[model samples]
Structures are given as structure tokens and as C-alpha cells.
Target: MRKALILSSVLLPAITAAGIAAAGSEEKPDVQTIVSKANLVAYYQGNDGKAKVNMVITDKSGNKRQREFIILRKDVKDGGDQNYFVYFHQPADVRRMTYMVNKHAQLDKDDDRWLYMPALDLVKRIAAGDKRTSFVGSDFLYEDVSGRSLEEDTHELTETTDQLYIVKNVPKKPDTVEFNYFTVAIDRKTFVPMKMEFFDKQDKLYRVIESKKVEKIQDFYTVVKSEVRDLKKESKTEMEFGNVQYNINLGDDLFTERYLRRPPREAIR
Candidate 1:
């Protein structure tokens, strides 16, 4: 199944399960306005940012594998175009692997991505195909790491609570996406999506992502911990972010293919 980016935790509580149907009489903002605010809150915190990531992938048997990396991001425009550099640091076998992505906000445009492997000493340009493919063998997808464009889907304000706004999203090109529709619960005050559910064409809930924790860093409400659970596979991926800094001075050269093959020591360190 295709995954949503800037997403949530793997397994949520029973409260949220029932809360999906809950509604309130509180006055609410328009769907477009709420979605625009959520997009900015989730992805456009600053012109540039840096973070250390720790990802734990668990299979149905409960076996766990860990991977660590550092990500550097720079936005050419507040919410239009962005550049990302991801450097893998852990897992002795995959150490020094790097990836670069150029994400465009326009739905008509496709993102550019490249991957480099130290072991093979080869740089491969990742072709655009299935954004739903597992990211480095984890439950997360390529779109999850880079992000999905807001314009790709149409949004509707389905329900509202005192603290949250439940929004339903239907992809503009339904045939290109695996999900029939998805629901996101956006925090009223912070505009962060606290929970998301993806439904298949059959209307069965097969995947859920939720934010478990959020903390303010550099005055930005950030999701520090989150997870993605595959209900059918009975597997999940838990991810944590640390050492997050916003508005850092990241030069444009850092997002080049040269950096993907020969990563800058300073940025990764």
C-alpha cells in the first residue's frame, strides 16, 4: 500500500479508534485553510533544517532491526521546492550510504531522487515509480521520507473536535494511488496531524500512522516520535528524531549528486 508522508505512529489506542467517528459542534476553519496550515506546520518549519534519525523496524515475529541516519533539508521557497540530503551512519554494512532528493510542490511535477552505496561504490538515480515502496526495507516509504505534495489530493473537513479537526483526503488521480481515501486528525492548536488512517478500495483499514509525541524546537511544533503499522502484515516501524535544528545555514551545493557520492563529513557528523 502507498504510504503518507509526515505521518504517524503504528498502533493507536482504543480511544482514537472510536474517536475517528467523534464530532463536536465547535466552529471550524475551512478545509483548504486547515490543510494549508497543516502543510506548513508539518514541512515548512524553516528555510533549512537538520535532524538525527533513528528507525526501528519490526517484523511480525517481533524481530527488530535498527538504522540510524542524519538528514539535512533546505527549502528554496517556504513551501514550493526543497532539497534533502540523507546520510546513513549506522549498520556497519550500510554505513556511508547517502541519498539526495529534490521535492517539488506541484502535483504535475515529479520529485528527483538519487541513492549512493559505499559498498558498491555506485551512484544510482532512483526512477520515479512507486512511492509506496519500502524505504531501506522499513515500513516507511520514499514519500514518507521526502513528503507528498498537498495538491495531489483533494481535502474535505469531515469532522471537528474541541482539540482536533478530522479531514478526509481523496487523491486527485485515484487510479494512481492505492488508497481509496484517508483520514487525518489535525491538532487544532498546532496544526500537526496526530493520527492518520489509510483505507483500501474495499474500505478496509489496512494501515495506520500516528504521532506519539510532539515537542517544540526552535518555536516549531515538531513530531519527535512516530510509527507506521501495517495491519495486514502485522508489522510496524518506529522512528525518532533528535538534535533537530531549524533555519540552519545549509548551502545549496549540499543537495547535489556529488554530495550523495562523497558526503560532506561536517554535515553527517
Candidate 2:
């Protein structure tokens, strides 16, 4: 087993399954290869998919904030990044405000972000190059959402409970994420992540995410509902997605920078 482990680690993609390829560098499939392929299979299919998301965020003491956000995603172009736009409408202070994310492939490159404040009628651009910064103060960092490469992390198959495959992910990149590691429980049948838990850099569990209501729309299984909890604060955030349709009539103009800056009725085109 040790001999097979050493050879698999050097192969790059199949490093996650070192034991299986122990005998020789003859190229047996590994978990990393499986994960990479599954991600690609799901990634490209959702390009240019638009959905109306209804979010209900609750703070401590059961105080709730409800809002609706429009989300649109575009394909990865020029090996640069995937473009996405968001706008929230609801709750008193944050209605009709827009947020844009320009996620670059290179972690060091600038990930341009902006938020248009309706009260100020001003668009504030968030500067990039803050590696230690969070994504607008969320528990997740910019790299967690933007960096799609699975090779940056080491994945281990922990166990199988009922019908789920629990995989623990630890980042290989130094100081990349604020968390020690996280466990993602994927549905064995669909390869969809059903639940996740994030641990702080101190190796303590920080947050837990549970996803339910998985459904297939336009040939993809999408998580329709999810809840996130902060272990330290006893606060939680719940998000529910609705009108979730996919792979339908998304044109090139839908991904243009002009539309990103000024979203029009033609956004779903």
C-alpha cells in the first residue's frame, strides 16, 4: 500500500487515491479524478443559468430578514473567470441593490466586486488583493467560491452513512481559507452535495450547512434549500431558492458587462 501511495501522489489528479494505484504508475482512477470529472460535468451545464432566489436570513433571537435576489451566471471565458450578477429586493434597507462578482482563475489576480447602494445612488467597487479578507464578511472567503480546482485541496473518503458519501476536504494551499477543513456529504446517486460543515483554522467546527429539497431541472440536480448555522454565536441563516429553472434560452448578451452594470428586463435573455 505504501508503494502505491507514493506513485499516485506524483500523478497529480489521482493523488486523492494513493492506495489504489500502489502497485504501479499504470494510471488507475482515483477519487480526485472522480471529483474533478463530476465537477466539470455539473459546472458547464449551468453556464448562463438564471434563477430567482428567495432568501430568508435570520439572526440571533430568531429575528428574520426576508428578501428576493436575482442571480445570473455566465460561462468561463478566456480562462479568465466566470461572471455573476446579483440584486436584492426586499427588507427596508436593502432593496433593488446590485452586487457583481468577477472571479479570476488566478487567486492572486483581482476579483472585482461592486455593490450599488440605492440610498446613495452610488456604486462602490470592492478592491481586490486582500487574501485574508472574507467575502463581504461571510464565513466563506473569495477563494472558496471562485477557485473551482479540486487539486488545490486534499479529499479523503471518510465514510458512508445511509446513502451519502462523506468526503473531508483540506486545503493544500497555505493560508488560503480561514477554516481548518470541511466535510461535504454528497449524495452517492447524484453526486450532489447534501450537507457541509466548516471548521475554523483552529480545527474547530465553526458552521454547519444542511441542504434539502434537491430536484432535477433541465438535466441538473440543484439544491433548492439550505440552512447555515454559526456554532459560536448560535445564529443561523436560511436560504431557499425558487422558480429555479435551468438551461433555457440564455443568450450571449445576457453575460455582457453592460448588463452587469445596468441590469435590464432583458437579463434573462
Candidate 3:
């Protein structure tokens, strides 16, 4: 009998069990290798983590709406399955709202998401479609919240600079994606995508996301501040993360539907 090799659903496109080779080393990696590493580095930090996020959504007319939430994330395995629980605290009307996600690394499967509204006292499952749709009326999309699967895009290493690796990514299914292609500039040292630009089929830049600041939190390099701009709409959203702590003990129970209606006080804090 032969044993089959189990592959990590996340990085199978490029990275292997050994890991990405260090930059400037003898073994330089390809675009897939760079993207695979960047995807993990950007999303999967410690086994589990928690953060308080403050978002300010500004419209073209200069109207601003504020939202505050506490995010709890747990990794079932690095570059594999993960779970997220978000509890909204600010903006009196939307207070006590909660969102939960069960993300699978499999590119073919859609992540499971659910939302809870305290005012209505209702929990509804979010249908997966057009992931480009605004999340909570913000410029950030649903895909941005869970993560964009590495396998959904084909990567090309266009250039390499002293501090960044520029890669162009084209979606596998053209009709399924809103943009014709997008480019990401990954920091060579930190493996974080410092900036990204999205272009429509006409090759017009429609959206941009940038990391404004990053700091080392508990030895892990983290993006503490970022912004997303909708060029067509002339709108922007600023996201700032605080009180970040990694490897927190977020139990599996927190990611369940039961918690959607009845959020765990401990997990939110």
C-alpha cells in the first residue's frame, strides 16, 4: 500500500512544506512562490489573534460614517482553514452586530459567512456571490475580509526592486471577477502586500489599497493602518487596527451560529 501525500490547500500553487527561500539568497523564487508566501504572511500570522478595528468611511460629498469592531481570528492550520468572529461596538444603531466566517483554503469552495443584527434580533447567512460587493457599505469587499485565494489568480513577477516584488495577477475566470487584472507590491523583507491597484477591463484604474503603516507586534510584523480608495466613486475608507494580540485562545465555539445571536463576551473583548 502506498500513502498519499496531503497537500496544504492554501499554498499548493507554489510553496511547499520547506517554505519560501529568503530573498537575495542563492535560491530566488518565482512569482507563485512570492505570492504564496505573501498570502500567508499577510493573513496567517500566529495560530490565533485579536484586534480592535476602527473604520471611517468617507463618501464623495465628504460625509463620514464610523464603525468600530473587535475581530477574533483562529487558524485551524497555517495556510489552511481559518475562522473569524467580528463584533461591532460603535455606531449606536449597528451596535451589538456580529459577523462570523469559516474560511476554507480550497479555491473552488465559497467561504461560509453569517451576520447578526441585534436591533432586528436576526441572523442571516450571507450568500456567496460577486465578492467584490462592498462590505458593510465600505470600500473593502467581502473577499478582502476572508482573503482572496491564491489559486484563483495567475501571478507574473513583473519586477523586483530593493524593497519590493511587483507582481501582476490575472483572475482565472474573467467573467467572475470585476477587474481584468490587479498588481500587488509585496515588501521583500516583510512579505506584506504594501500596495495594490485594481484595473477594469478597459485598463482604467478603478480602485487602490495601500498599507499606510506597519509595526512589529509581539515579534510579528503587522499592518496596523491601511486604506482603500474607490476611484470611480471618489470615496475612501480608512482602517486602523489596535490592541492586537496574537495566539489568543479563541475557542471553536466562538465561530458557531449559536454565537451569532448570542456573542461570547470573552471573545469580543
TM-score of 1: 0.87
Screening candidate 2 with a backbone cut-off below 3 angstroms (N, C-alpha, C), the clashing residue pairs are 4-22
Tens-digit lDDT track for model 3 on 40-128?
A: 77788888999999999999999999989999899887767899888998888778999888887777677888989877888999886
Look at candidate 3 and give me any clashing residue pairs.
none
Candidate numbers sorted by lDDT from highest down: 3, 1, 2
lDDT string, candidate 1, 1-269, tens digits: 11222222222223345455575333345686677667767777878998999999999999999999999999876557898888998888888989888887766677888889878888999886678788889988877777777777889999988889999999998998888989999998899989989999999999898999999999999999999999989999999999999988888888887778887777897
- TM-scores, all models, native as reference: 0.87, 0.75, 0.88
lDDT of each: 0.83, 0.63, 0.84
How many pairs of residues in model 3 come into backbone collision?
A: 0
* Deviation (Å) of 129 in candidate 3: 3.2
lDDT of 2: 0.63
CA deviation > 4 Å runs, candidate 3: 1-26
Model 2: residue 133 alpha-carbon error in angstroms: 6.4
Native-referenced Cα lDDT, model 1: 0.83
